[model samples]
Target: MQKREALEFDILFVGAGPANLASAIHLQRLLKRHNATAANPLEPSIAVIEKGRYAGAHLLSGALLDPRALDEFFPDYRAKGCPVEATVSKESIWFLQSKRKFAVPFIPEPFSNKNSLIVSLSRLGAWMAEQAENEGVQLFDNTAASAPFMENGKLTGIITDDKGIGKDGNSKTNFEPGLLLKAKAIVIGEGSDGSLTRQLSMHFPSISAAQRYETGVKETWEIPEERITAGEVHHTFGFPLESDVYGGGWLYAFSPTLVSVGCISSVGHDSPVCDPHLNLQRFKLHPLIANILKSGKMVESGARTITSGGLDAMPPLCGPGYLLTGESAGMVNMQRHKGIHLAMKSGTIAAETLFEALLHNDFSTGRLKSSEERFRNSWAWEELHAARNYRKAFDKGLYSGLVQAGLQLGIPGLSLKTTQLTLPGFTETPSFNPKKKKIALPVIPEFRADGMRTFSKERSLFSSGVMHEENQPCHLVIKREDIAEICLKKCKKEFANPCQHFCPAGVYEITTEPVPALKLNPSNCLHCKTCEIADPYGIITWTTPEGGGGPGYKLS
Candidate 1:
């Protein structure tokens, strides 16, 4: 590799997600206040780099925004033109059987959303980016951070993704190497299971226990205006998932005619077929959900992973000259099924600590450590602490997990007690024995898309607007050289080629026409990273391809 051109900045934030955007905006405000009273004014260059074609191009969420962080970030967020679909006015919880449903008599306090606002997360990211830019922060979309740049055993900056490389591993006519971005202070706010975060963890100390994740598949629907009222929120458990699986379904109306529906499946299941996309399709077949969307049109669809490990699984927040915020730091409160507010709050706290470092002209690990201290003292820490054991509670089974959750709510301090189940998701998956005559596949209900009320994965993916350059190198890398042997001999007999079933975008296919082999269609990738987390062998590595290559999630 040749030495690339370099760009220098006082501060650089990676991944233009809510956390980094909030950090940039808040830092500018702090600088403005300090300049007003200081003898010497400080003007430092700050920039944010995003991998998507635009700030919100790859963003997806079933978002219900708590006003706590918004109130502090912008006192009058509504007046300042923050994008909100609707204010939550009604809520309910339901337990569904194959064809019927039963509503819970009382909603749990943690599940309540009476006053929260429904939103399109992608749109919200766009709005936040505009605000940050207005504060004089530079925004660079279509630039993926390949890895953290290290110097003398310390974090320095990032290396952007290279371009114009052929699939054959040769430089193209327009080949251009990645740039070296050096910064005094760097903040990483990449969402769940980011590649850069994984690279950093290898060099730095992380939680002793493996982090947990849940794959969520979502779709936006245009239904009859009279079927459901705006601001209606509904959550359901049972029906689609098995007794041993921990997951559920959610439905929220952005308007009388537009609704967001999705399903989340825990990756910690003991079966190889924990497919979230298939689970969501099964959820729509229930009478309650089916009747509401019988005449609906599918508008958009996408998938993403949630960092559900909570406070205990969080890595150290700061290293030398670098800081981690948002989902990258595991700032979510899974009990409430909310994180956007917490992520934004973490960014604001990081801004405060970085602002102080700027004033003193010091960017050392000791100075960056204050950001972690401030986060611990903030309300975000308190909320996460209360829900620390929420996700792990479900490791036993749905009914048993529910009992544990109920007990936690009823008894003070009971939630803090950790369970003995500490195995990571992949290790829990059981293997099938080919020698056994009774070897059976995991049970997943059969579904056929009507192209109206229910949809196939291909139809849903079309709505996501996903694309990538076909001539570029495949981003899905199989770490082992014996992928074919594993997929054909061992995986075929023991696990039944799970990648073909787990990938939401149909990126992996097992073809038997010419010969029994593993095939990949990397261009169909939604950038969800599901294959990396759920693969039993942990052989798949999802890397960034060319810049601006991914789903264009607009109304998600």
Candidate 2:
């Protein structure tokens, strides 16, 4: 069965990140301001596809940039060469403690950033894919998307992965076949947990709620220009996470010798060994982050998964023909740990609802669901419904989630009743029951990777330049083909396997001398779907891996 090759488009856009490159440069500036006063002149064709081998190769972030949706659709985005890197000036907040740190005097207007810029969201998505290819938009970088081309029951575009398969799965005389892109409108912005947005959420299901996630784990240091300063921002939250474990840690600078650090757990944190990269190596051995990385070096590393369920865990922002902007549509807010300007304001409101469905040709789901009622009437929906209970108010722990974030920042109408206090990041993990009493796990304080201040995970997957071809087809699947007796007798008797501590690029090993199985080092993937979102028993999935392969993040 090798006879594919179709390629139309009126609009395609599937993850070139930064919300489909700000909806393909704001739908090419709203079709050049409505074809400069239409006299029946509505041009359509626009594309954007990227499965990253470029366009910020699997982009990662700690990226602070709230440039208000890039000053509302590239208002000369710093004169169009926009890759800011430093502007913040100074901001602070802290609380850590495994050695001491307290700071937090003010700076909590949703963790203020002052001027906000410190970026590298993979170099601001390779400079927003060069302003979405200078606004004409058809960009394709290593392309991926592998499915959701549906026909009668809607969608209509995207099918791209196949290419030279082989590790015994055959078809390898440089086999190609995998292109049936067609499109009348497709948009997806695949990011958090997105494998074609989880196979189109089983035919557009998602009546909101039930989407929670958080995994972060970044790095990118250099430090030592007199110990940091360019835009110096910081943010911390209690010590190595166990007040029932939600998490946080950051550092931003990007200049006083290039900073940007990380940690951000809570993928439903109960514990299947809660390791967000060993809680980012116990948040860099916090003596206030080891004296700001004592001498600093680690140039880059990555991990991701954070569509932190705000606005009640979003999902169906238009169906039928499709449209779900950034972070595949949760459009993160998490009380302002921020989502690249709410994913570039949901890519400029999915480019103003696909420019009125391309001036009335109507790409259906009720005319693209009025781009979700114009994103719930903008201001990125009042900053994600005023931080809608910020990540489920830390699932009721960390000091009752900092007293429900200090009463939703001193009662901003109680964050509109917190979307009924949501849940679902795999119900915060721990459940194989064994008589219900398990959790006590938090002791994780060991450290000694020291290839110059903590390194291993195979040297942070070789500084996260993660490569893979090893004769194709093994995009980390394991949907329980008895994954070695389910990782040796029920994940080693209830969670001891924890995918070798939630895989921040070590790619799950478990090999007891070729007897206990589950080896899979899928080219040490850093495409961070965090073992398919903290795999409890639901076997791991994370597809799409042969499109210029994962991680080459140039500074995450």
Which model scores highest in lDDT? 1
**Residue-by-residue lDDT tens digits, candidate 2, 220-268:** 8887878778888888887887787777889888788888788898854
- For each candidate, the alpha-carbon lDDT, in order, equals 0.85, 0.79
Put down candidate 1 lDDT per residue, 159-241, tens digits, no spaces. Answer: 99999999998999999999999999899998998888888876785522367788899999999879888899999999898
Best by TM-score: 1
What is the C-alpha RMSD, rounded to one decimal, of candidate 2?
20.8
- TM accuracy, model 2: 0.35
The residue pairs that clash in candidate 1, if any, are none
